[model samples]
Target: MSDIQDRHDSGGSGAGCGCLAVALLLAVVAVLLGRPFLTDDGDGGAQAAPEESVVATPTSERPRSKKPSGRRPGVVNIFTEQGLRGVRAAGTGIVVDPSGLVLTNNHVIQGATEIEGTDTDDRRTYPAQVLGYQKSGDIALIRLSGASGLKTAKFAEKWEVRLGDVVTAVGNAGGKGGTPSVVTGKVTALDRQITATDQSDGSSERLTGLIETNAPIKPGDSGGPLLNTSGQVIGMNTAASAGFDLEKKGASRGFAIPSAKALEIVRQIQRGEASDTVHIGRTALLGVQVRQPTTPSGGRAGGAYIADLIPGTPAEQAGLRARTTIVALDDEPVDSPGSLTDMLLRHHPGDTVRITWTNAAGERRTTPVTLGDGPPQ
Candidate 1:
């Protein structure tokens, strides 16, 4: 069950459409595990294309209910821009507080320079700002600007969920902006675990204690609600089985973070508690994409290779360039890209640190580089 494949859907059209296609593939999956449900618009600019359509097929064990009369009161459709790179992504979020506090999967808002949330009830779009996030747990909290008295989702008690319980997975499936998609099924398992690998950066993290269902969760459902029979939120939809085509298949298995666990993380974020796993605010950037070096024998060669440096970033301002190898950060040795990322995560924007690197000509150089604010990692 450990084998997982992440699939990227690029069916939509636009200027940066290809990026959205690639963004969908960024979901981490293990063997047979589906990618996290975040949809992309392809263009990173103001003009965005609508996400392709997604159809959900309910189980035959019970008759499907008629479509609800109106949109879910607390749920919102989420859209994000990743700087000027022209990559737009869409997902779902749950309103947790009346003052516009929203909860969602960290991946939904990861790397976003701008975020917008359209309430299902009001049909009004509001700008949003990330309050905090726990990247390891894949949970994030955001606040909508000028929002008040918003309806909040009801949470089911932790003891209320049981296997074989009927549940509905609701989300902005396929990144469609209007009414959220809903599919019903029974919970089949609990306490599930999986490793989600980000295809874009080869980074992966382990997710544990997930609720498993056959509710046909689809693209753009990430961070949406998995509601119990009484319309109480029991879990947050996170991932699904790869290639579970709803049009061709009756139902597909999906995974969700239990509401209890998600709520715990949210409480920590609300308390402004920053830990090894929780990031309190905006991400800091050295502004370089790096990779681990390999020797001729295919073994890792110590040091992170600077594949490219983003122009106008701290790395570029420090005179670091592509093809150089970063040896250390703040005097600590950097063995690989992951290690460098870990080191960076410990510091915040406006923090200055010593950087050590070697050029292609085997020339060693060291300097002080002040980090810059960047999109979420």
Candidate 2:
């Protein structure tokens, strides 16, 4: 008994918090899937929002609905595999429309060369294609054919969330790996800020203005929904580091990037721009860490300035000097931190760009930088 007790004592508790990840949270409420509960700034955001408009191929172009239902099945699954012969890594997705617009966590479908979904009716899993994905925000959308009777998940306005409210989180928790599961919890925070970790390498992704709940989440829950009492989804539960304990789970924990931001990404995919969309692997995927710069004109109140650039990142490769004041990316001018982060993540690595900036010496410079592929380690 003493020896067993000694080992238990030595085992101890770990509070490393995954040694600090810059990643954002992904909630995967397995089994059936539930929904929960569910911001930002300038130039980057400005460019990102306007250019995005989700376009779903009209169902009229596809075969007729076999079993017409009042509510379309709103959720589907994204499948991935270690190799062609490896065990498939599949996660849940929410159907956004009858035309088969689907929303899921970026991580859930990260390496998937293809994705597919099935409804309650034993409909065969149909082929899925990435419509568009924004890793910084932990969101992605896919397109499917031959899907009908799809139930669209209802969304709550961002302002509708309140603290202490009960919520249900649903997704495929254990995976083909296991069956889907659902967990219940309450809103511990509204507009919480927390960093998520990359499942691939355990790097950190800073996600801000997110929802928090004292709920248990696991690997298969990556792309699930956080549903309110009314069964309306206010936020897409993206992630939480597995290392956190019961105590740390609440205070300053878990994150759900809001639906408003998701609306932008979903719209962009619907517009036929989905095929070439980039998945930069979340966090400040921009490769540039920045702060809001004070301006002479008080322009935009919180204009953004590049603070640090990752080596070999698009920003660094672009010849963008650290601490430079970025006035624009492509044709859109950046005025806020969130905007800049979103804008940079919107473009994939190796993509070309026209960047205009003001150097510390007050010299106006235009440098062309090609976006790099993959995230900074």
The whole-model lDDT of each prediction reads 0.67, 0.50
Over 1-377, each residue of candidate 2 has an lDDT whose tens digit, in order, gives: 00001111112222222221223211110000111111111112211111111112123433322221221235554455322112245566777787777888765655343455654334447777665675556678776777766667787543255566576676654443222456777766655545543332223455655666666654445566777665667667666433433245234334455666677678875674533234323212234545556657754444356666656555676577777777777878766554554465555544577777887787878888765543212
**Whose lDDT is greatest here?**
1
TM of each candidate vs. truth? 0.80, 0.52
**Candidate 1, superposed: residue stretches over 4 Å from native:** 1-71, 240-251
Worst 10 residues of 2 by lDDT: 1-10
Q: How close is each model in CA RMSD to the real structure?
A: 10.2, 13.4
Off by over 4 Å in 2: 1-73, 82-87, 120-123, 157-159, 177-179, 198-203, 241-254, 272-377
For model 1, what is the alpha-carbon lDDT of residue 74? Answer: 85
Q: What is the lDDT of residue 64 in candidate 2?
A: 26
Relative to the true structure, candidate 1 reaches a TM of 0.80
Write one digit per residue (lDDT tens) for candidate 1, span 1-377.
00102211223322212111233211100010112322211212222111110011223334433343223568988887765344566788999999999999887777677888988877778999998887778889999999998999887653345567788888877666677778887876666666666544345677766777778777678789988766878788886423232232455767788887788888998998988888887777787766666776988787877777667788889888788888898789988666676677777889998889998788989989888887664
